[model samples]
Target: MKILILKRDKLGDMLLTTPMFALLRQHFPGARIDVLANTYNAWVIDGNTDVSRVWSYQRVKEGGRIHWRAAFAQLRQTLALRAEEYDWIIVANGDASHRAIKRAAWLGGCNLVSYTDAKNSHRKVNHPLEIPRQIHEARRMANLLTPLGISLPEVLPPLRFQLPAEAQTFANQWLAEQGLTPGSYITLGLGARRAKKQPTTEQIIRWTRHFHEAWGLKTVFMWTPGKSDNPMYPGDDETAQPVLDAKLPWLVPFRGPLKPALGLIFNGRTSLFPDSGLMHFAAASPGGVLGFFAETDVSPAPAQWGPVGPRARWLEAPKAVSQLEDASVFAELESLLK
Candidate 1:
């Protein structure tokens, strides 16, 4: 049997659906399990034993109807996917993967299912079952298998990852070259796709300085390719009016490690970021993580199937969900570090 899971979204969201890949493997055992993700998330699927292949697709939106370009891409992908003779395909991303769903069904199709909430998305197919939006997405993803006779495992499944052999070596050498030794170093992940979720430049600087001074750990500013340098943290009139012009290193350029950089911090290398793949990578690894997720109400915990382990401490604001206060964030971080 062959299976494919399609979920197209942000890095953090992809991190959530990984557990379902494992569940499929457990239920089916001998089948080829795969994930059809986006270009931005193909790397997360690497080092996974459960999945056989990772396919990437761009968001196909046009005319408020699936665009012709996107449709062509889907036709090519689905037609090729049909050749694999898959027995099942799980569209975990959203109702948007409906194109894949229909195409897969038309060409030597398979058992088709998708994860969607009637409250948030329209019912585009026959598989979606309504579930709580914030009820630990990983759990919900795995639960999707229960009705299908896939027995639930006893152990708390984790979103798994196998650190690339080369990356592990690179990380070791990277840290050594930076004069960074093992122990409890803090990865000050301070990048976010939106300004609202990210702290103001001044806030980030103050947070980094405080963590370094208090913990004696090095600060790592998480960076993403093509993401413009964030010189300012988010501020608005209706919300917390950020105190700026504090002469801080808030707008500091990313002068640290390189992408796929070989570096680790205090025996407990950690990362702090506003919902990005780097942060997820840290979470996916055994390393510690302090994740600040705003905008959405998703959980920080990695999928319960992957090799990468648990999220040490996840801090998010309540309601409208972004814009964390310094004092409150510190209190939370203090607890986690201990």
Candidate 2:
């Protein structure tokens, strides 16, 4: 069987699709599975045992109606995908954008399955799975496999991110050069798609100080430099500067690329984040993570996108990070450490 998975999204969205890949392999052991993912998120699907190959989809807006250039570009890409003659094409994640429906149809497969919350999108696909509200995102993707007779676990497995051997070597050398011990340091991911989700620099400083004083764990800050040109959570580096400028005794700065940063996360005692890509990264890691998420009536809550793992914990605020208290954050960290 030849199967194609269309999961072209950002880090968390891409990572959440890993369970579906595993389930597909379990149901159809001999099937050749290919994944269509964004250039940024291609790494998440890469090196997976279940996926035969990963096709890069560079243009996030390719299927959208707004830009003719992107639509034309998608047409060209679709021609190549259609040639593969996949027996089944599954659109694992769906936005309100009509582009997802357009892209799925354009790929031209024998059986096309998709999940969407929109009523209009339900009419366009062969199998349109209506996603349930307030469930973890991974479970929503896993629901796509029900048509194939795959029964998923009550608690889906954590997102999978495989770092290369070089990343591990780089992390070890970087930590050694910084005079830090492995498993005795905490990593603070200081990037957020929205300013409201980000905890103040003062909050980070105070928490780091507490962890340092109480647990003797030195803190390191990591961030991705957000670029305006990128549509998907370009990330912000500015959040890290305040912590650095404060020259806090226990704080260290180790900002760089994603894979190597993930290597450091793998070895760290624990990490903290504010609904950023790093939260997903740390959730994929073996290390513990405390994620702070803010949701209003319009936004999805922690119950929907919270981290999943034995050691992963999430604290939800009403509308912004400012609504969450510092002591509550510390208490969560203390509990995670225990």
Query: Best-fitting candidate, measured by TM-score?
Result: 2
The ten-residue window of minimal lDDT in model 1 covers 233-242
TM-score, cand. 1 = 0.69
Clashes of each: 27, 0
Per-model C-alpha lDDT, please?
0.57, 0.78
Candidate 2 has which clashing residue pairs, if any?
none
Error of 1 at 44 (Å): 1.7
Q: With candidate 1 superimposed using the best TM-score fit, by how many Å does residue 269's alpha carbon deviate from the native? A: 2.5
Candidate 1 on 105-212: residue-level lDDT in tens? 454534666555434433334556555355455666676665467766654367675555565576567657656666545665444455544666566667778877
lDDT of 2 by residue, 1-338 (tens): 89998876778788778877888887898999998876767887668898899887556344343666656766778899999998888887734436666677878888888766545473547776776666777887888887767788886655666877888999889999989877888888766767778788878878889889889999878887665346644656566666789998898888688888888988888889877667877877777789988865666577777777778888888888878888888888787777
Stretches of candidate 2 exceeding 4 Å from the true structure: 60-77, 94-96, 116-124, 226-237
